[model samples]
Target: MFRKASRLRLDGSPRRVVLACCCALFVAASVVSAQQPPAQRITTNFKDADITQIAEAVSMATGRTFIIDPRVRAQVTMLSSTPMTPDAFYEAFLSILQVHGFIAVPSGDVIKIVPDANARTMPGTDLPDRPPSAADEIVTQVIAIKNVSAAQLVPVLRPLIPQYGHLAAHPASNVLIISDRAANVNRIARIIRRIDQAGDSDVEVVTLQNASAVEVVRIINSLYQQQQAAEGGGANPLRLAADERSNSVLVSGDPEQRLRIKTLIAHLDTPLESGGDTQVRYLRYADAEKVAALLKEQVTGIAQAAAPGGGQQAAPPQQQIDRNTTIIADPETNALVITAPPKVMKSLMSIVDKLDIRRMQVLIEAIIVEVQADKTAELGVNWAAWSEDDDTRFPAGGFISPVGGSSLVNLAQLAADPEAAAEAGIGIPNGTTLGIGRIAGTGVNFAAMLRALRGDANTNVLATPSAVTMDNQEAELKVAQEVPFITGQFTNTGAGGTLNPFQTIQREEVGTILKVTPQGGSWRT
Candidate 1:
């Protein structure tokens, strides 16, 4: 949690101010930007120091790179207020530090830190001396063409169309509308026709602003629905909604879609909730007070909804169904995304940021069940063996061994009986081995599904092991135990020897949860 610093205050005069005055002449540039700028650009103050040096120190801490141009410094000075307190000085100092490249994270009284941007580079390495080159993106094509045409897009659209070109320059990765105007709809249609035939890969002219950042996202999510509609493509209206954070939602006409939306919300990196098919919502929160309030409400709501009378219709207008569905929250943004019945979405959105992991686990488990029931699992082994070079004749091994012929031994034996194997210098195979386990009796095909839901890449855990006990009234080892569902093994009316319970291996294998302890030993779940 970040808190105000006590040792500093915002008063115009402080001990540092008097000392700063004596040194002002030596660093006129450093103090200048601290005044004459917009209020948003206003800064506290620095006791006496070079912003460049401060930026460098901050850059070293966080992994991001920031540039503190002289112009930016001037802007800061121009916006600063008269006089300064240690606190004000610190805030200004930190702000500048951030602009230069470090994230000025506040932790209690201390301003915890890190690089504001994420850049991949070795520690202690300096940021490049030049500005970064722009990447080759689709938007660049439009910008290039616009540059060649001195007539601004504004001029082209102002007189003829509803003109919405101002939205084209949003910095974020989202859609922006560009109104089309060439006198009439026919002229616009003709332009589209020409572009379609000319094959201009990047600059597309569409009938509507369909491919803008936000719209593209909506179209991508509706890919499946759109495909289905396209098969029978007609005049059906395509509706799209986004949960908060601008994530698109699947449009559903009723309750089932509501549930799915809820489920997906629980899975997002940011918490998403189920809202009615009509509305998509995203909730953003930055302040600590708001964060606290949101969390408290979420927990209370979840608990109440889980209660018996929680969803009672007779309850007051605010009463909601007690469905303790889980919500997932984004750590960085403190935003919650949820898809719920419109009612639920509206009522529960306030607490979206308060979701926890337990609900997430339950939702995931449900998905696992659905996912596993539809897939197949397989297992195999990679093994090592001896080659022809390892073959040898033993003249008197059974009291007679090969006197002059080359002897052979496995690598394992050579390691254990080094003296003897080394003397023979026998060849050995070194490789891995794999094998699949068979279901003890039923032989049901479920391996693929089992693997999909349970496989752990790191430890080679691939499936849940289950066992069922069988009743043996006759108490005969040869006969299959008298199990409730399976046929008697001993009564095998088929060809093989009567199924003998004692001869068969029991399905006793079980998965053990692997946990690393502080003492370095492992324990099972």
Candidate 2:
């Protein structure tokens, strides 16, 4: 019974120890719960509130610390219809700050808010002051200026640039480098485009062939100076230069000014004419001279014929004739240069047509002659029996045997053999042996005939005859001859050769014995 009681006591003691340990754990958990802050629920709606106000509201709602940088000046609005947890509240607050160009940074339990533009930090500091936004933001752009010098253009464009904008000109390259705000840079580019387009339209180069370069330059300068003087020194932007390489005048100015100058140049380049019309009539070489002479004679005759009535009428004082027509004969070009009134020129041309109607007939005569050399001389010599060193049988050194012939020997047989001919002096030229071996009749060997008639004096070969050999020997020749002749006149004339004696006698008697003739009279009774 005592042993069972001791065992029950031990069990009771373990239950008490278990109860004590549970009580200690409950106390420790209660202490930890008391030390931790409770999760806060936030609910807020702020409309277009300043960043400072938004930050203060967020801090009050979340029961968290927030340090707002003095430079965080951006405004923001926050709206939340439903209740927000602590995390949601922080997220919404930070998003508001960020939307208003502020950056929210957490440090331990506190959040630091700084302007986004001023978010830069020094090595040891958390935030630095932000520079002005407008002055700090810079953009660069390059613009091309055409036909206008950048030095001249920069001054005009500099005034258009904003105060904070900067412009630089690269004159050698004709480009402008501009640095300014995005809006200001765009404005400058527009101005540059307009200026460049205007300059392109104003600039022009005109090629001049017959006009004098110096004279053109002088005229352009004079016009520009006059414009300057008239406008009281506010002259058109004009640059005039004469390009000697291309022989052109480059005029760069306002379009109106260039037009005026071009008009003046046109007027200067036009040839001045007198009150009469000048006409050029082309005539034959001889006809040009004849027309000129005929015009002079006809004009003189008309002037003389319009004088007093008759010789017996005691012709009044000879009235001077107005020979207003001038005719010049240009032999070089075979043209008649006429300057007169329109009607007078027309009348003169009509007369010239009548006087220049003579026809020039050309007679062509031709004769073909075939000259043949007496090749029968070659028949007398037996070339097979002829040999060198046989002076009695064949002439010495005349007919050389093939074995004894030198390499420079030009034998007749070499003409047939090209290799042998090349071994001899020089190879025969093409067509040199055209009429060899083939013989028909005594007609000429054209090649030999040509050689024979080379230096003839009277028979001038104006053009080489179209000579062709029919059967290697018979050659036909075709030649052309020109005979120039003019119509209406022949130098030689003759009387009739056939005559009757009775008629001749009767004619002489009738001439001598006339009935009632003016000089003499004869009576036949």
- Per-residue accuracy of model 1 over 214-315 as CA lDDT, tens digit each: 433354456546443432221122234544343334343223434443444334323223222323234442433454456456656655665555455555
lDDT of each: 0.33, 0.51
Best by TM-score: 2
Runs in model 1 deviating more than 4 A are 1-295, 298-322, 337-341, 350-525
**Please, what is the TM-score per model?**
0.15, 0.22
What's every prediction's RMSD, in angstroms?
A: 40.7, 32.7
| Span of ten consecutive residues with least summed lDDT in model 2 | 1-10
lDDT of 2 by residue, 13-68 (tens): 87655744553453343334323465534456554345564555445545667666
After superposition, which runs of candidate 2 have C-alpha atoms over 4 Å from their true positions? 1-135, 144-152, 161-175, 180-183, 193-254, 263-525
